[model samples]
Target: MCLFTETRIKFRLFEGCAAESGTDGEVVLGVEAGTYQVFALPDHGSAYGAQWVGLTGGTGSQDLARNVVVAAGEQKDIHKIFMDRKGTVTGVVTGADGAPVTGGTVAAVTPVIGDAGRGRVAIDTQGRYTIDFLGPYAWPLSFQTSTHAFQWSGAAHRRQSATLVPVTAGQTTTFDQQLALGTLVKVTATGSPSGRYAVAYNNSNGDVAGFIWVQQAGGQAIFRVMGGQQVKLQFAGGEPGQGWYGGTDFDSAKTVSIPATGEKVVVYPYS
Candidate 1:
């Protein structure tokens, strides 16, 4: 068997606002030698690795929790920076009636803070989905379907309660979720300001769904979600007004619901 695959690995070295790319797993730069953040992206469907600058050649633990220092005329051997094979995560999204949720989207979100190692896959007609390039460990995942509301791996509306799925390298970890459709509410908001307004569903703790609606001209910002669900309206790019429903902080944004079929909320942002 071949020892290495043909997948291309990319390396990104970051030093504050400056960045450099190395396709051969090692990068060289002509700048001041200081500490830098090391980020690795591989095409073999693996999670992106982020750590401190630690380039070693011997069979010892590479120190990645600190910065890397490069000196003049010193050649750093980063050939050991290789991407490992990605693990697999497979699962099914079902409804409260024990029926399969077809055409749903399953996302394997890593708890790594940034958008690294997060993978999304579409549920097949049989409500089955497989996400690759994952680490061999528990992954906090979420699902969204047309007939069901957003639910985490723990069957809860909150993402913090989502259970971590244990994935295996070169193997598949099977998991499933049962969801229920919540009350659908029509949401609309209008405000006056030089900034844009964004709307999303919040459960008094964290965001539940990843959907958002943005309105920039103080016009209609429309969407639908669970009724009476705590949603947040975020304002950006402008200051708030001094009138009613106007403030300089996040509390100035309006939280509304579809109490009626065609009702809308008029918020004053820059009045």
Candidate 2:
């Protein structure tokens, strides 16, 4: 006889416009009176895949076409969301020196479906990780470690150029990766408002590399990326005049180059 550890699966309720996480398999949401389609997502690392409410199987967000009508001061109960088992991906993570790398994570993203079908898991002491549940499709995997810059599969730095791993239902696929050293970039924001602020970095391919929140005024955030990569930064919330770091939009935004020894930059008021 063999015993396997059980993974706890959490649920999330989505209505195409807003989404909220559920506790203990139940969710209560407050929305304006309207007609909407509901979608349910199992938390990452679960053995079950996401699906639309009222349907047992749905491949994408577009399949969430069933509508639930809501009126003023009305309360409704959506039927139980049926979860289906999805594909699994298991792999080992090693450093450039060819040794097992511990204390990191592996993540999966289905670009076509966006965040609706994403999953992640932590690497164990043996440098092994498993994304127990993911939609059956081609997905790009991201390997992240403290000592290395996060890299997509095939050692590509950006998602657009990374290799896509194919997955099948009720099956497990193996992928191994060796991380490369990355440059740590620190960003400090001054003259920020008293609330939280979002800072994100994007590549020319329009792919977001990473993001962190600045909790207070003059707070700092940090991320790692491959050296020589040109990326743009975006700041959101906290003040009236906040947008792209250097320009009004992505196309016109100024780019910063990451160096081998790392770099530091400051975001001033209105910039």
Candidate 3:
């Protein structure tokens, strides 16, 4: 009997004020390559869009393949895909007790000549680890934890049998992030702004989440209230003017929560 592994990620390619395409990524099934459907879903946020296809030419035995897409966010359910990958990797550093090692930093040394992407992922508590990595063939990788250091200065190979595989065209590889162990401050927000619109929850750092904008259509705002036990966060503010606007008050704004773990919040005000 033959065995294989598969993984997936929710990826999307956004267009300006238009329908966006979403992907299910690559799906790895242990079947002799012949032909399969690579599903690529493009959502108008109102209806179904299109589908993509890929061909796997397997001559039997363990092999690798590559698929290509014209657009982004399209999931490919195919019989064959990347038999080889050109990118970096991510992993966790644990103690002898099988515990996650915290405060670790992984570094990338792969040069563009070798086709290398910036490989970096923060290990969360519970020894969780992940990496935003890439490697065309095999690339050297270096890692450092709070107390220990490790190196896989070898070729970073892409898994052939992954459910979520990268396309030859637009690729974004996600390595499962697992850290040895440490205090994690996962932040979440709603109405966080990006571009000219206000998107909630711009939790980049523990400091600022993100920003928003007000148009002539209507004024918008966010709200956040405070509590005693492990303060839950929320945002509230006002945009009375038209065109573009912002805020400059704590009352126009509210207090937020500090997380013991990751958090989620949403608050906005309008005129």
Candidate No. with top lDDT = 2
- Candidate models: Cα lDDT each: 0.47, 0.60, 0.30
Tell me the TM-score of model 3. Answer: 0.23
Q: Write the per-residue lDDT of candidate 2 for residues 144-205, one digit (tens) a residue.
A: 66677767887776655678777778999898888876767776656555454344454556
Best by TM-score: 2
Q: What are the runs in model 1 whose C-alpha is more than 4 Å off? A: 1-21, 24-84, 110-118, 190-198, 201-230, 234-271
Check candidate 1 and list the clashing pairs: 45-133, 241-269
Error of model 2, residue 157, in angstroms = 2.2
TM-score of 1: 0.53
Candidate 1 lDDT by residue in tens digits, 109-139: 3111112222356789998988775545455
> Each model's number of backbone clashes?
2, 0, 74
The residue-level lDDT of candidate 1 at 12 comes to: 15
State every prediction's TM-score relative to the real structure: 0.53, 0.58, 0.23
Using lDDT as the measure, name the better of candidate 2 and candidate 3.
2
Off by over 4 Å in 2: 1-85, 110-118, 188-200, 212-222, 235-237, 240-243, 248-252, 259-270
